[model samples]
Target: MTSDTLAPAKPAVDLEGITKRFPGVVANHDIRITVAAGTVHAIVGENGAGKSTLMKILYGMQKPDEGTIKVNGEEVSFRTPSDAIDVGIGMVHQHFMLADNFTVLENIVLGAEPKKGANLDTGAARARITELGESHGLRVDPDRLVEELGVGDRQRVEILKVLYRGARILILDEPTAVLVPQEVDELFDNLRELKADGLTVIFISHKLDEVLNIADEITVIRRGTTVTSVPRSAVTDARQLAEMMVGSELPTPETRESTVTDRVMLDVKGLTLSGGDGGRPLLSDVTFPVHAGEVVGIAGVEGNGQSELIEAIMGMRALNGGAIHLGEEDITSWATLKRREAGIGYIPEDRHRQGLLLQASLWENRVLGHQTRPPASKGIWINRKASRADTERIVKEYDVRTPSVETLALALSGGNQQKLIVGREMSGEPVFLIAAHPTRGVDVGAQAAIWDHLRNARAAGLAVLLISADLDELIGLSDTLYVILRGRLVARLDPSDVTPDRLGGYMTGAITEET
Candidate 1:
């Protein structure tokens, strides 16, 4: 069927000339969009392209400087998120706003608790939540604690929250970012079911493939303006969408010509890390070796000791057993800073928490790792001039989009922030690199750039331990792959023979055969 035939009889949300401005930047400029009911509209853009700002305006989190919003063809203004909720509009933020200690039912009914006879009617709330989840295909346990659930399960709880509030239009920001491939497929299936039942979904994502697969229409935003809004059938493929997002052809990486070296650079011998609360080992007997000019990828569903593995390598977490050897030296007892000085560079999984200081300036963050070293600081006094120059060089080299080095790290987009972190970590010319979820929230364009950079680093005789939840990315980048299931190495494969589906099966503990 044609898009027009499939579209709702009436537009669900019509935004005209939506303009929002921050102190020094015009975030959204004269943008116009129309999302029809019972349809999935995908918004695609580069980091810092103002897609988030536009969605915030729609969700009543931010006020527009100039705009007109029509819900069901009726112009209305929303003073708060509650006002938007009253009109059947709900937003699921990228970072889940859930209380870890609270039960799922409590979290879903937090703001608007059910009451009967001057007492909290939790039983009725739980029943309603269960019904909403079952009817909408978003299965969730209302009594489970948030801290005990996986990332995908937490997202389901968020969706149930909105459904319980009787929302017809749902806004999901990067919903599938933390999910595995299978979980992503299940989410898409649920979304299709919701659309079939006459629910309007606004899906914001950087992954073009998911957008093309799920969205009826796609909108491209560039530099705080709507570049184009076209039906999905009109666009040829992801390459075209990527070009539109970045506004240029991305640089391709040079193919590796050097033969893989046989010299081992780092080795892990039965490494084990105990969980904090007297639990079992987060990483149990995980052994791997990385050679020069090689990339060894660790692929698995997240929280299966990926974070613990990286932390053990960096010496941030205590190892319960075994040792880590860098070349010929035993460095298991070394401090994190000592490991860094001994030719180890690490890109952490959570950029906001472990990599960049959001409130600090870009230049300050750039030189944070090198503050006590030469060129950045001499003893206690920092060399701001040298640091700014270095920051500028890193920004240009990494294609980081920022107005100035003096800008706060939080002001930059997610992709740019990640680029800055990667650039800083890789700038020291370390012999070994440990990258954990390096490209989690990056766009395709940036993802390509990062892969090229890592490949180049590998080609230059650096040993890389790449950990990721994206199986496709892992297969594409690594020469060898290993699977981790419940803190144990379950299988290994050569990248040439492994498929994403097979890897996904192993990652979720469905299949355990080695190829």
Candidate 2:
């Protein structure tokens, strides 16, 4: 089946004059979009740009305050996701909704489980899931528990789940955010195959390059309004798309003089951590030094002991073997708080899981890393006014879009949340900063701003250990890049000497030869 065959004869989904409002916010105003059948329609915008809100309305996750939705020219309304699914629409959220302990087949057919003789029909569901995977070239292990699967495989399971439910229009939100380069390539291939098989895909992404590469038409959203929709051929380049997204020409970071000080701010020597099986260490003899005024980037596929390495460094997990030193002091045995107090600023990879309390107000989240900072506290009494003032400063400086510092962190857009987190981490002025995927899910404007901030921090003589799945980001920002494969530092490259393709080859363990 070709995409041509799969797409409806006309527009598969259409929205006109959509409007949604929240307390003190107009989430979406006079939005209009038309997604044709069998074409990859991309929605690009900064965080809190109302793209997600519009998608939610389409998927029936939320009812629009005013608008009309049409499926194949027929007006429709969806009060719940089930209603959308019933009309052949399925949405894959940024966060996977699979139960870790459940088998892939179980997760796929969860709410609509087949029944045989008053019991759940596991056999039929497994057979159906296998058929769907084979038909779509998805290649998933239906019996494998989600917890045992890699992130890429887990994403595949999510896609298969939607396909199994007979969805004709597939919506993917930031599908490549967590994927490595190879995985991203594979996903694009799979998406192309799906399109060829006649499925309409509405792809939401912050990465303009990917959108231009895959989309037939592109829709750019700014703030809470629809800026314009244009053919893929019209935009010409990422710069044009970026201009539309931010309504401004962004400045490129200039190559700076090597201001790296000879003194080592952070040193890791022969660091090793036992794997889950407790045999060979997951991190084997990893050693590196972070010097002041330099950004050292670790580029690796996910689960190559990067998480373990960060955990060990932060003192959240014990090290099986190795030593970590901050300046001249050994901190391998110190508590996480003590390490932080000793001048370590850590922005964890999983922001929702480890970084912020979603339900807490912005001020509370802002003061998290610096509860002991002067003015935030005195002896045992917490100073609310001082914390609010500090948060307001960050909000104003970082351009965080919030009505007040008392707004729940969860209510902010992904980009704004990231800005707040970055601001909080940088505010401490730590000697060493550990930033993992700091720009993930953020728009181009915010990404440029973040790069500028990191450069300024480096200029101020802060040593940075940056970890990211974004190969371009790793190459663009890092002075030196290290690639890890299966818990080993496989190759190190000067950023100027290596391309993203070469870096990806090293990251995927396809290239073992040292550069």
Candidate 3:
């Protein structure tokens, strides 16, 4: 026999004819994928392209209507998450599933605690955890509370949780979504370590650059089916993979010509938020100006006063001391509704929490923020017919894919929900916009579309205060950029002069502002 015949014939994972369906939607259709052992395999797709559905099926969170799954060359069926885990497969979710009050050890050993004579074997578990940490390069103090950990450390804990359960095949979903550039590098390093230790990883991400950098094999999913799978050597870069995923060249956020005007639309001076109980101030003398037809982007690690600044600007939170001006009008003491009525549009960070009513119909949600304006309301009554008509316009113009306007917002994908919110916020032609993580959890196409909308609005003299964790987005879309450190605006720079790597230095306080 030849060497090929003597070699192993089966892959680490094999899925054939995988199919799943929901009401009026075929989430996955005849999907097929093969992953090699001891390598990083990446899955890339658009927001609504059925990637999550497929992952759910594989993890046993959802049952496939039709398919054959093979792990380690043995055909298997998983009816629950435990079944998958028993087969050596473990999944780390996109949204973390951990109690803040729990210690790291408790969170990891909650379901699978070692027992010794009717007592939980805490000593044995700690020893095992310590060993695993050293072996996998995923070290964390076992006694640290989950709440006290940073984003990167929390992620390490999640990885350890899965590894603690004896998982050899790991699935990580959007693993670096909330991480800064430095954290992303560390994550990649950890992934490399996993690969070195004879482990298989299936990484799902929307970040093409990171995927290209780390993935050994790539699979593209579109709509509800597999488009293609290529080895890393076959593909050149992120742009190529993006075109394969969305069937076009990835859109750029670069603005060739400046649209900034001297007309100042948003001005803040001496913005401060006191820390109760006489601690440090949450916002310290924050000051900035967004002129008409300009996009002023803020770059920071999450929780560094970006959210507070946005809320303060929208009048959703009280400031300790400051003045907010909109077109020369001081709106310091205005209520949230008054700010909206005065032409302030807000795209909140959490769409499900602040942007849409999940149980309500799409048409109903279209009137959410614009309830007092025309096309959504007439006099004291909601114009349901007009609102539905306008919803149709938004769905078409914004490329929101859905069956009908009567569908509940909960049934729509996250990207579609975000598109609806963007449409609603852009309706009244607000003079100033606060877009916080506007493109979070969205695919490349949706991101490009939103960036286009912002650019078009900027051209029409709309000022935008853009806050995003995406350094490239901030650098490409902003005329000016601010770096926030511990609730203070520490550095200001022209967007043209900064790179993402350089901006990451400012964000992490590794590089100080040069006076």
- For every candidate in turn, the CA RMSD to the true structure comes to 3.1, 3.0, 2.2
Error of 3 at 477 (Å): 0.2
What alpha-carbon RMSD in Å does predicted model 1 have with respect to the real structure? 3.1
TM values, all candidates: 0.93, 0.94, 0.94
Please give, for residues 1-515, the per-residue lDDT of candidate 1 as tens digits. 98977954778899999999876688899999999889999999887788888888898888999989999888989888888999999999878899999999999999889999898898899889888888888888888999778777888889888888889999999988777788899899889989999999999998787898999999999889999999999988777888888865543323335446999999999998877788766888988899998889998877788888998898988888989999998999999888888889888888888888999999999886667665688678999998898899999999998878999998887888999989998887889999887887777678788988898888889999988876677887787789988798899887778787888888888988742
- Write down the lDDT of every candidate, Cα atoms only: 0.86, 0.87, 0.90
Q: Which candidate number maximizes lDDT?
A: 3
lDDT winner, 2 or 3 = 3
Kindly list the per-residue Cα lDDT of model 3 for residues 340-380, writing each as its tens digit. Answer: 98999989898988899999999999998789888988999
What C-alpha lDDT, on a 0 to 100 scale, does residue 333 get in candidate 2? Answer: 95
Global fold similarity of model 2 (TM-score):
0.94
Name the lDDT value of residue 148 in candidate 3: 70
* Model 2 CA lDDT for position 201: 97
